[model samples]
Target: MSVTAAKGFTAAGIVAGIKENGNPDLALVVNTGPRRAAAGVFTSNRVKAAPVLWSEQVLKSGRLSAVILNSGGANACTGPKGFQDTHATAEKVADVLGVGAGEVAVCSTGLIGVLLPMDKLLPGVETAVGQLSEHGGEKAAIAIKTTDTVHKTSVVTKDGWTVGGMAKGAGMLAPGLATMLVVLTTDADLDSDALDKALRAATKVTFDRVDSDGCMSTNDTVLLLASGASEVTPEYAEFAEAVRAVCDDLGQQLIRDAEGASKDIKVEVINAATEDDAVEVGRSIARNNLLKCAIHGEDPNWGRVLSAIGTTSAAFEPDRLNVAINGVWVCKNGGVGEDRDKVDMRYREVHIVADLAAGSETATIWTNDLTADYVHENSAYSS
Candidate 1:
């Protein structure tokens, strides 16, 4: 259940004075042996965090030995100074670990437009490096949380290899890889090219499919490190599959813990003319506040679902559409099928299946129900 007990890497977390509450806000994960090949994905937001910019450059070499992450101060919108802070943080870690700065990726989350507390962060990095251990994954997970109630981590073992990951995010979560931070480590002997390929594929299906608040974060990054410490190389197919399972698990946890969420909604769009169309349909519906609010209110408003899909370019004739909620047919051929009152919404999980009646392509996206709490939590978040 602990992050370190999962496998592949050693981690440590310490209070870095980044948060006013003095919670542990700095974390480090080191691939202790056999240097690992690395691959990373970052936010598509044109405005990126300083750590994201730094890590994006480091990942180009396809080699990584460690990662340093902090919460409570997202080093974004601080201009050149933010970049300097990220570089300094990585350099401090590299100096202690005896590795090049490029071998360490940096990530940060929390309030944007502010500077990081470098005075405390630099020393905190030293303490984290000293506490590294295989069982320190949970602590590292804990250290990176902003509004999360609990740390999110997942481990999957396949034959001779193990893949594990830690994630943190409770708000500002949407597609293009949620406004979250994720670090995945594996003992599989994979080259950087393969690692990159696998990570992209996995993210496309998992992280890229979740939209909780529709607001993207300034700091979002997913880094994959392979230690090859196990000395057991599996087929690339097998390794990628294992990595995907871990990502899927973490993605689900992110949605379940979404800020102010009362229910986790899974939106499935089927029969689209193409995969892109399927995803477009799914995302439009996932990001619709009206539909989300309807679901939260236990209102089987199939009309809202249709209206959301109509806003997309999924090539579906309005009259040919069909909708179902929690396995109960609510609409058929764009008209009401069963009594809306027959559906139950008391459960924590909700499913919406939309049939485009086009081609065979399909996609699924995970989102959360909208509630008054969501508005309250975000409206005054920065205050």
Candidate 2:
């Protein structure tokens, strides 16, 4: 059901003519709630989008009644006018929902540096609001797609409570805070503090581990809202686990649907002295373009892995390092160890293991192979 799968929430998606192609480009998600508790994370890029700046301020109140998102324009680098557009959008949502403008959060995604068609969007807001329905979650998810080929949604249920989420990203998929726009809703009895705690814990290992193209978006946003309609107060740990499960699933889906990617690579860093060390090593391997090209070519290249690790500050002994590809140990003690000819590379998924031999901590990062399709898709992206 996506965001509207949770109790006390309704959503709708409509064609706003913001996209010249006439696709449904605007989505509205509302909290018909007994409680309006929420938390969010945005892109760490210094060049933030106008909508992100507005939503970041709205979320400081630690409550949100509704969120409006559009996929036809990024509204970044458009100066003060862009922020005004976002502000006006929130005011429009507030007017219709009978709430203060401060209670509404807004998100926009698409080509950067372009102004949105407010003549089309402002009126579309009223139309989308009239069509709000709990079953409209899937439509909202579909409306967020840009270069993505598929819509992403995930749901997990527990006793008397459930968490549902929707995400969209096909490029600029890197980790800082979030790589794309994601909306998560839960029916549990949670306050803003509880949600902030749960969301930070979830995105740490999930969204933060995905590094598809190593490019961070200026408008990335991940928001979690709670309606408290289930009337069930779940344990903090249990609720956090459920949130993590949904984020993890959505992150994996983003990687699988990454733009022009032929192989999905999973890099596992083991035997690290600390979790941070493991994560750094894994992220380094995941972002290595040379290693990604090797995986796409079905070539077992242990040298590239060592080169990536050497650039990181993670704890490791050069001579004691080990590397494995698809269950075949290709390098041992920082040199050639296993037969590269025995490694399998026919599958779309490739697994690479890096052993630091420093301790027992571990972490994994997901990435996709670079290809000609990726270059072409981005080169002609704005046309």
Candidate 3:
């Protein structure tokens, strides 16, 4: 259960020949709501997809009745015709769902700069809208996968309401926000202002901290829609916490399933002067290609960790720094502490802790180890 795990949402996934392999590539999520309030976050990338541009404008009214998503064409760098295709898509879904085109949000993923097969995609909306059901969340999640080995979904329930979401992204895993495409739904009685506040606060730490492959996508989009079907108005802090929990879970799943990764690495930076310092140091370590390769090889390379941290502008004295791999304090006071031979690196999950020895701020950035399979998959991805 994803979006449909919450109330007032119906979803469907279908194949409309958008992919040559005949796999599912189109999805529709409709909100049969008492409220149409919504909030969204898109890629900070300068180059964005046609759908991203379309959805950005549509969400200005803080209302979205449905979201139409497709995988197999990014519709980026295709200029005016690409935007026209995205517009035509929203219009089709709006007509079917009996909502204005401006009230529908659209998202797409796949190869960059390639135009979508509108002939297949436009007609596919009809099929998806027809099949929409409250039980269709899982199918909708599956239809949006690109390089992911499995579909991702998360849900959290409280007294009388629930928040649920689905995310799809394996390659281009790093993001100011990642989607490749994420849709979250909640039945709680919240307005657009509240939803926007919570969505930004939730993503700031969750999606923003995930850095697999260190590459952002052109089609990234995360949307939160409120149906107010549960009729429960949770305290703002409580509701925001619930949203954060789902985002954090989904972010971990993305790291676990990073394209062709052999290890899930968690880089935790501690005792920094500020939270921003901790995050900067942690992200630097997480995105270090050399460090990722070392992790993939199961080589407890503490030197790479220090080297990675040093490159960041975060507050840290070289001599006061400390490093640990797994549970072994391999480096202390900037020198070798425990015996390097005593560290074990056979586990699929590796944890690296860096103590900045500055103050009491900390952050964790989840990432993945680089492997030959990653190169292989990406090299042939557009084929």
Candidate 4:
């Protein structure tokens, strides 16, 4: 479906002079309200970007009229100037929209330690405001990307409500939201409490489970805004489910498009003592570069998976572990299975299953295969 038909929100993207590439670097999303509640989740990294800190504070009100974002400068570790830049950006957007500064949230991504060029950014916000349209979702998605090859977006409809989202991330991705930037828009009527609860739960399973390169970022942010534009207030349960599905799709896409990545890997942990245990075990495997590299090489290395899981606190007997790759049983009773050669790593997708043999719980994590290209790309990233 078209992003306009799906999101029912207005957006704009413009080149704000933040990037040297001259590509679009500033974006704006506004809900032409019937004002709806909003929810946000920022990076878990203690060293957060200035925008992240500002948005987190504003999100407490559960009311958002607009979001302003920029790329090419993270505005992290820039000290007081960073906060001032964020404040100035939001104030500008609020002034343009005739709303309070606190009513607008801000986000930024790109190079770290560099100050935001207010001279370039201030005027860019004005240009973005002029370009707002329902068709701007795709442009906004592309504007947020740093090393990503493509923009990620997803939409789903259920009952009478719609949930739509755009995401961007390529490197410095790991759990606790994956060094990603996301904006979710919905027309369902929901309160701040319900939106916050739903966003947190959905993120725990989706964005929180993806681990690409295992490095977190200072600029990750996921903002969800409900415009109540649909005027359809479905049950909270149904609305949350639709939101989860959108996040799940976007999270998988982020893994698929990770920088220098050739394969998207799925790690599943089953029969853990509890859901938390299952998630922990799955995440451990997802974050292991050695295991990811082994999978990239098409080596059904059950030992690597087992070793990674061992680092987790999940209660499991190593001797009872069972491993499978691409539906081919590669290990049984903690030993190598007979069909290890059947698993292929040459494809763009890879799957690994680990049976904890402890209980009836399961969790899955999405990741990217490690390659020498990944090393080369990151090694020279700043050069």
lDDT of 4 by residue, 1-383 (tens): 21333445888878888889898888888888786589999888999889999999999899998999887878889999889999999999999888899999998887778898999999888898899898888888878767777778898987777889888886345222235788999888888899899999999889988878778899889988988878888898888898899999989888888877888888888998999999889889988888888878878888999899889999998889999998987888888786777777778888899999999999998888888888877777656
Give the per-residue lDDT digits (tens) of candidate 2, residues 18-40: 98899989999999899999999
Report the C-alpha displacement of residue 369, candidate 4, in angstroms: 1.1
- For each candidate, what TM-score against the reference? 0.97, 0.98, 0.97, 0.96
Worst lDDT run of 10 residues, candidate 2, spans 170-179
Off by over 4 Å in 1: 1-8, 171-178
In model 1, state the lDDT of residue 234: 83
Taking the tens digit of each residue's C-alpha lDDT, what string does model 3 give over 243-311?
999999888888888878899998999999999999999989998999899998889999999999989
Clashing pairs in 1: none
Predicted structure 1, TM vs. truth: 0.97
Order of candidate numbers by lDDT, starting with the best = 2, 3, 1, 4
Question: lDDT of each structure?
Answer: 0.87, 0.90, 0.89, 0.84
Predicted candidate 1, C-alpha RMSD: 1.9
Error of 2 at 149 (Å): 0.3
